[model samples]
Target: MDLSFDCIVAGSGHAGSCAALSAIDAGCKRVLVIEKGPPEWVGGNGYFTAGAHRTVHGGLQDLLPIVRNATAEVASTTDMDPYSAEEFTADIMRLGNNQSDPTIVRAVVDGSRDAIGWLAERVHIPFIFSFHRQAYLVNGRHKFWGGMVLSVEDGGKGLIAAHQQALEKAGVTVWYDTPAVELKLDHGHISGVVVIRNGERLQLSAPAVVLACGGFESSVDLRAKYLGSDWERAKVRGTPYNTGDGLSLAHSIGGQLAGDFAHCHSTCWDANAPADRGDRVLSNQFTKSGYPLGLMLNTQGRRFVDEGQDFRNYTYAKFGREILRQPGGYAFQVWDARASGWLRMEEYGDDVVDKVSAASVTELAEKLQAKGLEDADAFIETVAAYNRTVTAFDEEHPSVKWDPAVKDGLSTQSTRESLKLPKSNWALPLDKPPFLAVKVACGITFTFGGLAIDPDTAAVISEKTGQAIPGLFCAGELVGGVFYGNYPGGSGLTAGAVFGRKAGRGAARVMRS
Candidate 1:
């Protein structure tokens, strides 16, 4: 096999795919992609994602041309509000607690719209309106609640297939089960990568190396060391291959680390999910993000978080951390017939979770007790208190209407007769018969900390000199400082494409210069 290449990309996931394709577009004839897993485990975490891509668009009209599901009839029924650049940036800054790296965030925001267009036109990703996940049919219209909208037709699997088609058409080569073990440096510049190819340690020559390998969320030891004491036990929501190989390779060559090492983009996952890996058939269906329309009770049988604090898109990522903090590292989401019908079937379907249901709230608590709930009486009392509070609030504001498509001020927060905890939006009494409940646990998506890089060029920065490391580029979950505490939903995929494209162009520039 030829060991020489103009550019080498580590990991064949979404970010690496974009990097490789961008390099080819930038006139690089010899571009290689290396994967740590076998051909069956091809796309890494990108294969397990929802394939949601958050970007700026001029509402339904601007996105109509790109999305396959947006027919004329569908467009008439869809009421999607335009998402602006400012709104997108504000979301990240706000959710991340204003700690996102400004330069990196700005570049991703500025490049987001174009990246979406490229994914549709160049990569041929079958984009569709995220109707099931982000929209609710209200008043005979599909009203999109959050700023996020588009997703791949069949989610991440489809996204990977699309990238593979693009890569094959571009004549790019991908090597499976060939993990990049180390980086070779020559005169303070990146030379190539050392890889365990065919059980032999081989050194491949390249002027530019793009590291899109992902985070340390897979390594139990690394998870405990970086994310905290409890993170080692957090359920792995994606690929087991993201064991921080690229992080180690970059660290060996003085790559600086930035972002939150103690935090990650986690979510409320299925309590029965496997501890260390994701189910290939289930994928992101394990996510239980329907808490906004209901209440979550810990073992103590009391509401822990404001379930309706914000749109699920803004709050779902960090809520997993809260779940891990609860007693026995678990919680139960309770909903009645009034709100249970709103939960997405993909996530809460009978086939997806062990659904526990009862004809009344008291019986629901008893059924939940058999499924590991601690205080059945407390669960019942919690329901009674919540219903009473909602009833009182309704009496005060009789004209208020409960709408799921927006933060319609229907809430449990009141100066009088309110519980200690509040449901900030979409609050309705759990008096409707046939209550339902599901056990949930923390699912770690990706670690937030990673290599520091130049926002403009996607070039890795050195810890030694605090300057850009020549021929070294980073993107995807392995590129940090774009997020801190929490992240806006769908921003991760968008940032990957933006920085991946930038890294690809930057890689080609290294050869020319």
Candidate 2:
């Protein structure tokens, strides 16, 4: 086989796959994909997601084909609000504290819907509404809020499989278990890539190379160096192979480092979850969100953060860092039967290692005490105080238009509840029987720090020269300046697809030139 190619893509995640597919579609004579991970775990961080993608759509009418089981009955009862490109961009920028690169943010927002539609139409990837995560039942109707409503049928794992099939159908060759060791730059121009496969080192020449090998989230040393000292102990939420290879590779050639190094995408995961990569079978099952419906207590049994500050999609990523700040680097999500019903089904699954249930608050406190809770009595008192200060639940009131999807926060009886830290939304008194608690720890998803790229062409930009490095492109989490302090769920995948496709086309054009 010829070892030379027009374009080479590193990594086999959603970004790399899309890069390869677009290159092949763009009429590249030979496009090669180098994946360091084993074939079974080739999708990088995207393999563990629920496959949610934030995109602009014209309400239910525009989503009917993409969302599975979109019958008239379901459409009438479900509120799939229109999401505009402006709204999507605003959400990302607002959540990132307006620090995100506007050009990249605009690119992501503009291409998001088109990317999803392309996957549905060209790649034959089936999508469905993430009813469980983005929907709430209000007055016998299911209302969907947030810009993220569409998801792949079988989550991230399935999305990877679909991409693999699409790549195969497109005649793209993927070299699995092959890690790119070095980039061969000739006269500061595009040249070739050095890779090792099965203990054999080989150099393959390519006019252009696209780096989509993900972030340094899985590297303990890198985490401590960039994310903070406490991040070394945080659980990795995705593939362990995603060290700093992509960042290092790009940096070695004068690529600019950008974005918030101290911040990352994180969540509250099970305390006993593997310190390395999460379980593929359970996937994101260990994540324990929905704290707005209940309360999160530290080892000392105190509410440190406002549980109902905002929707879980907006707050889940940053809250994991808060859990790490606790005494034991963990916390517990406590809920009663009433609130339990509103919790995501995964919280009640068997994969949760530290789940405990009790018929009464005292009994629940005893169970928590057994698990090393510092003060069981204080926990009970905290719950009592919360209950006394909470607004009365009256969803059936004739004068009330209580819709969680549209409501600002959880309703209070008269908006005059007195408390130190109040539950801003979805506050219900924990007066029901069969109380439950799940012990949780911090799970770091992906690092926000990465290589800077040209916003329009997805070309890697050199900090030293302040110009694009010829024949080098980038996409996925490895491309920085997109996220900062926080992230809106489902935007990562969209950005990956958007930028990945652009990188492929750009690389192909470079090769042709």
Candidate 3:
């Protein structure tokens, strides 16, 4: 069999799929994608995502032509606000504490819409309006919030299926159970790669290799080393194949390590989920991101972080880290009957999670005590104090209607009985029973640290020479400095596509040169 190829991409995930297609688009005839997992394990972390994509657009009308889920009747009832390039950029910079690399941020933000467009047109991704996740019906109209509105029809599984169809159509060959173990460097330039296939190591010759495998989030040792001791206990939220293979292959060849090594994108996941792998059928369903509509309490039954600190898109990524720091590496989300209805059924459906509920706060505390709540009395007192603050605020602003579609400032801080750590938005009195709660643990999505790359070309940057390595390119979670402490909800998929396209084109150009 012929092993000769112009460009060989590592990892058969969304980023690698985009890179393979883009390489073909850039006039490269022979391209190969190497997959680390068996034939069953494809799409890497992308297979476990919600398929949300955040891009700049002129609200609903601009997106109507691209999405299949929107109809005349749905558009009439939908109220979507325009999201601008500036707003997207500010979100990353602000969430990253202004420490994110400007060039990387600009590349992902500016290229998002076009990358998504390419995925839709060339890859035939079935785009949808994401009404279930991003919008809530207020009065009559479905109002969109958090600046993310586009997704695929059936989430990540659909995304990967579409990519597989496109790859077959494009004549891009994919080798399953083949993991790129090392980058072959000749005279300070990447020559090809050495990979393990079917229990044997083989060397493949190619001028260009695109590394889009993933980060070190799945490695228990690496998680303890970089993200801290508490993080070692965090649950893996994606493919178990992403064990920092791409990052290792690049860094072994002097690739610069940048971004927040101590930080990552995590969220409140179901406490009962598997420790090291995600459920293939359930996918991203274990993600408990409904805290923005309720409250989070530690084992002591006290509020830790402000649940309404920002939009769930902006805050959910880092909130998992907060949960890890809690006692026993878990927390409980408290919600009343009113706000519980607002939580997505995909995540909080009766069959999806094992939730504990009671008719009163006292009874709820008693139920939670069996689930490992140390101080049931403290939990009861906490709820009482929070209710008092919300009641006080509601009395002062009686005309204010509680709307979940926006940051309806029904705050607890404005009241005289406000707790020190206030629920700054969507502060509703948890008076109505039955009160409900779900046990959650930190679910790590990906690490924030990895190989640095040139923003323009997606070529991996050398630490020694401060220049792009001749034949080495990377995208997806392997390209560091695009995110820091946290990230916006839908931006990860968009970033992967943006840099994937650049990496593929760069690899093709490297071969041609």
Candidate 4:
């Protein structure tokens, strides 16, 4: 059967929901949103995100000034204090290494504030300001909620429910468990989407189609192809349904991909560990123990990348690149009691500390003996040195330059003060008994690369000539390079609102014309 809609949005994640709602609100007579999985399962990398929503204008206008102001405010709240738009742009450019699309970057940054504000106005959704609350502390109950659409339940369920309510209110039709199998193109323009529902193919025509179906974190072949062998071989900890459906369909329609080489949250929890109980962990846990968070070391026990370096300055991809140079493509985080104590302080609510302490460092080494670094003594020495260096650093550099956007600085400072440690102690020495060590392997949550799009209109762009792909739009993970290298505080959800609205409104306009 032939069906038509003013706009068609694939995926019901944050981005898809926002886009559909925006389009219908913009006066589209008919809008249809298709999800490959059930709404309850409409989760990808976004579910695991820290929920940072950075905007400049505070939901005033879709422009760059608002983004700069919002960034400044977020920085101020985090104690970094008063960053400029130019600085924010510089950070983005430096982070992305100048490979991002300038136009898209400008649009995303400029429109951030308004997008966040728009989401905050929703009656059912509650938006929390992350920076206003001080940095994330180890055991402190810190929940990040800025410009995010959260439900009353305070989990993925809440976010999905909020979006569903908004979409329904705006007169948008949602098709759950309906996977878009193909894109229909006519005369070099996207005309419709072919969806698979209950084993039957249904062709739904639209004037324009928006692909917000997220990335391929769960797809091994796509991960291997776009990311690296490590990602290809590693286990996934993000959404299961994010099988690169949008990428495949877009590629079939001649859409070009960008940032295919990027992925985020390089370190993940060891699902294989019996104690882990199939939960994910980050490599930064090593840093919590006063060891190098993402430093590089060889099988023979050596230092790489100044183990004391900050995680914000580098991406997980960089860490993965470093770890791959070591023997067996794996590394260990070594630390004694003092280091474990500090880690325990920081990881207050998290279960990492408990798991690390359940067994001795020697026993832990034996557990990961097959992974490499079988010498427990060498690991112990490494922990000792790490503790000494951390203690020394605390004495020398009393002031910690904690970036609030990523973590809770106030809690960190409070923890340090309570311990009677010097203010500059960036490193907490690991000195206590029963030293702990754990083998860490890289894991990816989502691919950073996908169809290139115009930030202003959320329209896909061709890589060959840098022109907008007519009648096609995209948002969320499908839009590459929007986050540059380091993801800003809340850009994921903000992008869903900003670009989702733009794509929806743009598609509706096209339908009317």
TM-score of 2: 0.96
Please rank every candidate by lDDT, starting with the best: 1, 3, 2, 4
Cα lDDT tens digits, model 2, 163-184, are 9899888888899899998988
Name the better of 1 and 2 by lDDT.
1
- Where does the lowest 10-residue lDDT sum fall in candidate 4? 275-284
RMSD, one per candidate, in order? 0.9, 2.1, 1.0, 7.3
| Weakest 10 consecutive residues of candidate 2 by summed lDDT | 393-402
Total backbone collisions for each predicted model? 0, 2, 0, 32
- Candidate 1 per-residue lDDT, tens place, 269-351, comes to 99999999898899999999999999999987888999999999999999999999998899999898989989999999999
Q: What shift in Å separates residue 130 of candidate 2 from its native position after superposition?
A: 1.3
Q: Which regions in candidate 3 have their CA more than 4 angstroms from the true location?
A: none
TM-score of each: 0.99, 0.96, 0.99, 0.76
- Go through the candidates in order and give each one's C-alpha lDDT: 0.93, 0.86, 0.91, 0.58
Decoy 1 TM-score against native: 0.99
Error of 1 at 206 (Å): 0.4
Candidate 1 deviation (Cα RMSD): 0.9
